[model samples]
Target: MENYLNALLTDVMLKEEEIGDICDKACEILLNEPNMVNVPSPVLICGDIHGQYYDLLTIFKINGTPKSRKYIFLGDYVDRGANGLECFCLLLVYKIMYPSNIFLIRGNHESKDLTKIYGFYDEVAKKYGNSRVWRYCCDVFECLINACLVNGRIFCVHGGLSPSLLDIDEINRIYRLNKLPDNHFVNDLMWSDPDELNPGFSKNSRGAGYTFGSEVTKKFLEINNLTMLVRSHQLAFTGYQMHFKEKCAVTVWSAPNYCYRCGNLASVLRVDENDITGKNFLIFKDTPQKPSSVGLPGYFL
Candidate 1:
């Protein structure tokens, strides 16, 4: 697997039967992916890599990996930094070596009680002393893919607008079994947030979803004919954040100096296959040293 992903990019740690055969082949490729997933335009979306594994290897060393482009990953790969299980088993070994160019959704700390109160369940029971590889990576994060849409007119998600989501086939008829749920619509598409001076919903002070606005993101992109709404749970010193006027939403945040003391600044959002309103916004920072085989102790929610 590319020398086990280059020995987990140099801080090796993957032999609990190879993370249970990479969580049984990434839960059989996230169970035939559904709960909303379409992806097309010259991809590369990314956001929140809370595990900061070398800033996820400096986002493939400034956007150019996964064999030369194509990604999605709006999710929080895992709790706090210090290689959250090697940044989620090197993104499930690049989604089992590029399953149609890798995509993954489910954020809000990929639950199971927020990785046992953040820190990926004690960094997987302190590096596999047990927890059966964190219960096969929480059954592959309950078969991920909660939202994504790209070429049909962008709408990826990690969180934001979800009053039972009115369309996108109601996010492909939800029902993402096990863990994650303290409120509906798959915990508001993984914990909503986006109130640029409230023009609609409210509540979320992290007390569980709902903060939405901008006319509820322009009425959920005019009832799903969509135009834009990419997401990533809060925190944007300059990494990313745009709302209502930027035509509804955008929040990418590839985790720069976030919990390492929120000096924030990190992003990603390439798009532009045939000009899906052509986009770009690489930005980066953080990584001035913090890898002497990281000794753990970083936290964020």
Candidate 2:
């Protein structure tokens, strides 16, 4: 596992068999974790990477590797980028290598249907000449946890609040192991977004999940005894956005120069006990990388 991780970090492409092995091991690790994965404090909370491989590398370059810092990735791991497969594959390797230091949550894109519609399905086929690897990735996605708690106070999820969930603990009742997204709970958690204008839950323009407002966020936080809600599913031009008095909830966007054209900044939220707000946003811009068209048409993200 260490060799695999090192090779990936250095841009050494893993053989198809090696990737399959990594995926198998990753699923094993993820399946054992609860739906609401419990994470420790003083961890970096990363948002959507969207397969900007060079930017993903920049994150580790600025902050040390998993050996030096902990991370909770609020998903959308693959899709809309040239190196989506590489990004996803490397994350799986890291998960297997450092199960205790890294955490990954499900995103709306980690689905077979969405992958097919987005770029992952075709990306895999283009890379491996078959959908075999894509299927393997979907299986691994099935085992990903829905949300995570940091130091028992911060509530973190891929998306925002669900209309059906008044209590955050209700997330554990939703079965997702090897199951298709045939349930609304998973849909809401992975697809939901926050709307600043609305005062209550409203239909999302995304055609799935609810767009919740400040009142909804406050109620959810109070009901769960949580200090803040950290989620990532929408694009934030400045890398991060605060909601409900700038404390109740936040969206952290980590894909810099989204799709290489949106000119948006990306950031990771660092949760520390010593910080005044117990969290800090570490921001960065897109880095230079070899050109490719695999992800150029990713505006749909």
Candidate 3:
């Protein structure tokens, strides 16, 4: 496992069979987790990677690797960038190797519906010469946990609050057996965004979920007795954005220079052990240049 991780970090490509084995192992691990997972604090919370493999590597460089620090990735691991397969595979490798230290939640882009339109599908098909690896990955995506509770106080998810979610129990009861659905609580959990302009729920421009306001966020936090809601779905020029007057909700974007053109910074939220109020925001910029192919495959370019 260490060898595989090193190879990926250095821009080396794994064989097709290796990817299949890794996906199989990841699926087995994810199947055992419930819809709402409980993770501990002293864990680093990160948002979307979107196939930016080099930037993902930079994240590790700035915040340490998963082996050294606990992490909860809020999803959108694939699609958009040039190396989605490598980015996703590296994360899966970490999850398989350190199941207890790492937690992953589903994002809207994890769905088969979105990947087909985005860049993930073509990247995999082009690299592997078949759809077998892509299919296996989709299977694993179905089992990804939707939300995580850190020390039973902080709520972590890919997107913001949902209208149908009154409590964390409702999140655990969701049946995420297929691709994300429109107009469904599961979809909202992974697709919704927080709105500061509106005072209540309003239709999202994305046409899938609602944009909740500060009142809605406050109500959700109070009802759940949660200190804060940490999520990632929207981009922040400064890498993270804090909403609600009390800093009850935050959006952390980990993909710097999103889509290789947004010129946006990225950040990760580090919560110390037994200190829910101590959120250390670590900011990072994109790599000066993309990593060289080196031992990578010919198709990497």
What ordering of candidates by lDDT runs from best to worst?
3, 2, 1
Comparing 1 with 2 on TM-score, the higher-scoring candidate is 2
Each prediction's TM-score against the native? 0.34, 0.93, 0.94
Give residue 287's error in model 2 in angstroms.
1.1
Q: How close is candidate 2 to the true structure, as a TM-score?
A: 0.93
The better-scoring model by TM-score among 1 and 3 is 3
What is the TM-score of candidate 1? 0.34
C-alpha lDDT of candidate 3 relative to the true structure: 0.85
For the record, the alpha-carbon RMSD of candidate 1 to the native fold, in angstroms, is: 17.1
Q: Please, what are the lDDT tens digits per residue for candidate 2 over residues 64-113? A: 77776888999998889878888888777778778888899989898888
Models, CA RMSD each:
17.1, 3.9, 1.9
Best by TM-score: 3
Tens digits of per-residue lDDT for model 3, 1-301: 7888888877777887888888888988987888888888788899999988888888888888888889999999998887888888899999999888888899989978899999789888877678887887888788788998988889888988788777778877656785445677888888899887886888889988889998988888889888888999888999999886777889999999998899999998889988676368999999865643444457655
The digit string of per-residue lDDT tens for model 1 on 17-111 reads 88788879888888888877887878888888988778888888877777768898889888888677788889888888887787889898987
Q: For model 2, how many clashes?
A: 0
Candidate 2 lowest-lDDT run of ten:
292-301
